[model samples]
Target chain A: MKSKKWLFFVILIITTPLLATTIEVCSDCQIKTIKAALSVAKPNDIIKVKKGVYKETNLIIDKSLTIIGENQPTIDGQLKGDIFKIKSDKVVIKGFNIINVGKDFANSNTAIRVQKSNNFEISYNRFENILFAVYIEKSSYGKIINNKIFGNAKTEINSGNGIHLWDSKHILITNNYIEKMRDGIYLEFASNCEVVNNFSTKNVRYGLHFMFSNDNSYLKNKFLSNGAGVAVMFSKRIKMMNNQFLKNWGTASYGLLLKEINDAEIKHNIFEENTIAINVEGSNRIDYENNNFTRNGWALKVRGACYNNVFKKNNFLYNSFDVSWNSKMNDNLFEHNYWSEYSGYDLDKNGVGDVPYRPVKLFSYIVNKTPETIILLRSLFINLVDFSEKVTPVFTPDFLIDNQPQMKPIL
Target chain B: MFKILKYSFYDLIRSRWSFIYLMFYFLLGVVLLFLNNNLSNAIVTLLNVVTVLVPLIGTIFGVMYYYDSKEFTELLLAQPIKRSNIFLGQYFGVAISLSISLIVGLGLPFIYYGLFISDKIFEFLTLIIVGTFLTFIFTAISFFIAISFENKIKGFGIAILVWLLLAVIYDGIFLISLIYFEQYPLDVFSLGAVMLNPIDLARTLMLLKLDISALLGYTGAVFKKFFGTNFGVILSYLILIFWTIIPILGIVWKSNKKDF
Candidate 1:
């Protein structure tokens, strides 16, 4: 009988590391705090938090675990510091209401921060009044999905981004609704990220901004009424498709501002009613295809040094200036685009216009040189002057013409 | 003065000219709303028409009414009515009739198209208000010109010239000068130039509401400060009111001194 009891004890000890036991945490339980529960948890343990308000701050997770909250338990940080700083791989945090993260200039007080972690899933969470929501630094293979972040960002001086990814790769950010942040989603030096189906609106700066981020593709994200709109700068091989940029109207605002970007593919996008849609500067070898630019101030403003860009099958409708160029130099190719202001006739019954359409208006050139001249837009004299300039190509770049202008808008 | 105003108002209303004007606006509103099918964009197109066409109609109608009623005006002058009342009453008559034609003409089609329920109702109201202001302003200028000149052809010619200058040529010159003086700061100067002309003031007011995004795109701090707030609207109203009053005062002065 003594030998048999020893054999059972040895088997029980050997199987303890593979089991994932659930620890219940509530106000009335023995382990009341998530911090206390996490301290006693194993690598694959599951912590279930009950429905209650827990005033906690700086909860660090250094081991792989699953933290699930029942009925959206509110974790009020009380404006102290970062909450739920994950430092280990394979951590999952779900169904928590986080609020009141502190604002510090040096170290951002993030709601859910993952540092040097991999395979983390922060989903089904709500954040409000946060300095930085979901701050991922040096994290890879993380999915920040289905999270709603609302920030009280009144000014750009002290505001932080909603989902700030720094040096993170292979991250998936999808189905997030972020509002009133400094920037909705900011990525710096991050690569191979896929951001899809996010609604970012009313931010103080760009809705989705990228700096030196490469091999990223953002699809079907809607950026509306942001202060400066979206900017993809200093990036290479970025693919943006099927996005809607609407009503981001202000002084010096645009739907998208691409600067020094190379080999980017922008297709199937809608730019509507923005001040300036798609302001390109120094971007090379970009293909802008099948996008709709409607009712903007300037549909496309090539500021300077944009070369080898191909604009094909895009529709420019009712914009004040279809294409405005600053310098007279032209190396871009515009083909098969349908301009609403194209008055040319296709007498041969072909889909293309008989004459090539010149889009760079002399008045827009003048307005670019002396921006105050924009006040004379749509005036009779300005129209006459533009007409004369159109009749005789002078001041504007003569080589900037759509050789095959579509008679009908590409659906 | 009220009697003369009523008489002139009825006289213009009963004429086929007012009917044509009313029908023109009705057709314009109907075609714009139905064809465009978007309330905001239709209002923009209507604003373009209102800024240009309203002044042309107002100037020509004012000058034509004055010359057509010349002998009747001389008869009224022989009566106990004051000269300022005589000229001012005729001016108000033309202005009010034209404004009513504009309102009733444009209002019917818009109200039919569910403008009151739409969010663009305020923009439509601004367009109407600016249209009325333009009507009053240009009519006063034309009346002053008609009262100052005795020769019928000369008055008509000068009236047309003044309209052309304010509507088209002035803007031409303003654009040229702004481009020529591009090296200097031109915010205050451009605003002053816009305020000096009633047509330009009305257009600026309309642009403040319609094309605010593009207008604010200019990098001038003064321009941004002015257009970004309600200050530009208030100043436009003040300057537009000043424009209306100046011409009426000119009519009063010119009529009081002239031999007609």
Candidate 2:
């Protein structure tokens, strides 16, 4: 009797794939709309929509279904309301051009919204003129890939994010091109998420931002020319690697910002032509290694309350100021870094310089005290003052030295 | 004006000081380029040298040239030539010669390093333009100072003082004032102050192109609107030209009224 029950269970598991059915939706078909198709879709069914324009809004998917487009169908929301409110597990949405989602601030007005679901996939879709592209809330184990999201974002308060995650975990977001949104990707209380190889640019606010999120990692991403670059704030134990932050040049812009972050590792990243490459405030125990800081205004600006951060094997190339600190106290370690402004000789013929290199200049310290002193940059008096300060350290912390300055840049 | 301009210009072209000035820039360009072997990097270092050294050299050379040429001037005053023609011609002579040295000196190393194929040619051009403008403006001011005073010591002293004020002390005062009034909005005031001084205006022009304006914060925003766009840049160039013209006009006015 037990063997017969086991055989019957195996048979049922094998036959579940055969039980799934396909429903076609076309302009001339009996089921003309996605709403009509979804009304009859049971669990484990496919809704294949043919090539045409379907003016739909506020459609809900409540059952496990695969919705595929035959030739990239267009679903125009017509500035009405939310497009697809997905609330089912194991759902798949693919190959659709979604446009004209409503611009409603109170409702957050998303093109595709997923809530309280898992094992979902949203891929190969295009969204334009949306308030929010994809809003994932209370979701887990989902993949959002290869979606091009472009919004008409002009102001911070009037726009929404491209891919937003709230209270989600173990999600993978990859290969998405996001532009002109409030933020390209925003995570709030979202953890264990992997964001990889995405190009986010020209957002009204930050390209990528995280608030109160922990254990998240982003790798191989390119963020360019946004209002500000990636800001990881109030997060812990994050990993950032192989990312390119370029041309985020503005008055108050930084390539990366860390506030109250702990135990994070930033490696193999390139920060080029930003106003401030990395701005750190109240961040502790972070390891910065193998990064390139190129032609920025201030390569690193330590605001306050930062400690135990180690900078090693990085390249600082042709920045106006390599580092700027507001205080005379430092608990950070800068070692074995290649500074293009380093003029010390190595008499021992080793790779390390015999003399220590001080990265902070007296002018930068004065600029912090009097922001107007920035206008005096590259002036004769400032250079003279900085040279005297370098000879005898007084204003800057005496102990803040890179004793093992590399003779050549680390490749 | 053309005859006197030609005589003084040819005389300056044959002088040793002009050769030294040209050689100074040539050596600087060569050393900077060969040391770094990077075009953009050399341009950055050259920015500092150009902004500071250009004005200093122009001012000192102008004053010294004026005093050394005093006998020549008195002899010419006894001739049939107009006073303004003689002074303005000398002014242009000094300015044009210095500009030639700066351009030919810095430009050779850049062009040899394939600046045409490289993308930093615009920045290189901006640097040369700013350098030339600084030369003309400073030379004109120095000539006016020389003409106003008969005492050689006082003339040289005031000329040095004026250059020091414009090149160094003015920035010091501007920075202090901005810090003193930090509670108020300063973008307009700062921009106005920068526009009034030829040195500050030239520096701002170069700094804006170098992406250092981003450090100015909100003030940088206002400056970006005023100095970042094509209209603003062209307007700045017009202001720089005005800077050159006003001092030259002052030289003419003072020369016409002088008893010497």
- Tens digit of lDDT per residue, candidate 1, span A248-286? 898878999999999999999999999989899999999
Q: What interface RMSD does each of the candidate structures achieve?
A: 1.7, 2.3
DockQ of model 2, rounded to 2 decimals:
0.48
Question: Quick one: best lDDT, which candidate?
Answer: 1
Candidate whose DockQ is highest: 1
CA displacement after TM-score superposition, residue A49 of candidate 1 (Å): 0.9
- Model 1 lDDT at residue B48: 76
- Residue B223 of model 1: what lDDT? 86
CAPRI class of candidate 1? medium
C-alpha RMSD of candidate 2: 3.8
User: Model 2, range B1-260, lDDT digits (tens) per residue?
Assistant: 88888888899989999999999999999999999888888988888888788888888888888889889989999999888899988888888999999999998888888999998888899999999999998988888888888898999899999988987788778877877988776777877888888888787788767767677653446655764466556777899999999989999899999886
Clashes of each: 0, 0
Candidate 2 wrongly placed segments (more than 4 Å): A1-19, B148-158, B169-196, B219-239
- Estimate, for each residue in A1-411, the C-alpha lDDT of model 2 and write its tens digit: 999999999999999788879999999998999999999988899999999999999989988899998899999999998999999999999999999999889999999999999999999999998999999999999999999998879999999999999999999999999999999999999999999999999998999999999999999999999999999999999999999999999877999999999999999999999999999999999999999999999999999898899999999998999998866567899999999989899999989999999998888888777675676678766777789989888988776889999999999
All models, DockQ values?
0.54, 0.48
Residue A39 of model 2: what lDDT?
95
lDDT of 2: 0.90
lDDT of 1 by residue, B10-64 (tens): 9999999999999999999999899878888788788778888999899999999
Interface RMSD of 1: 1.7
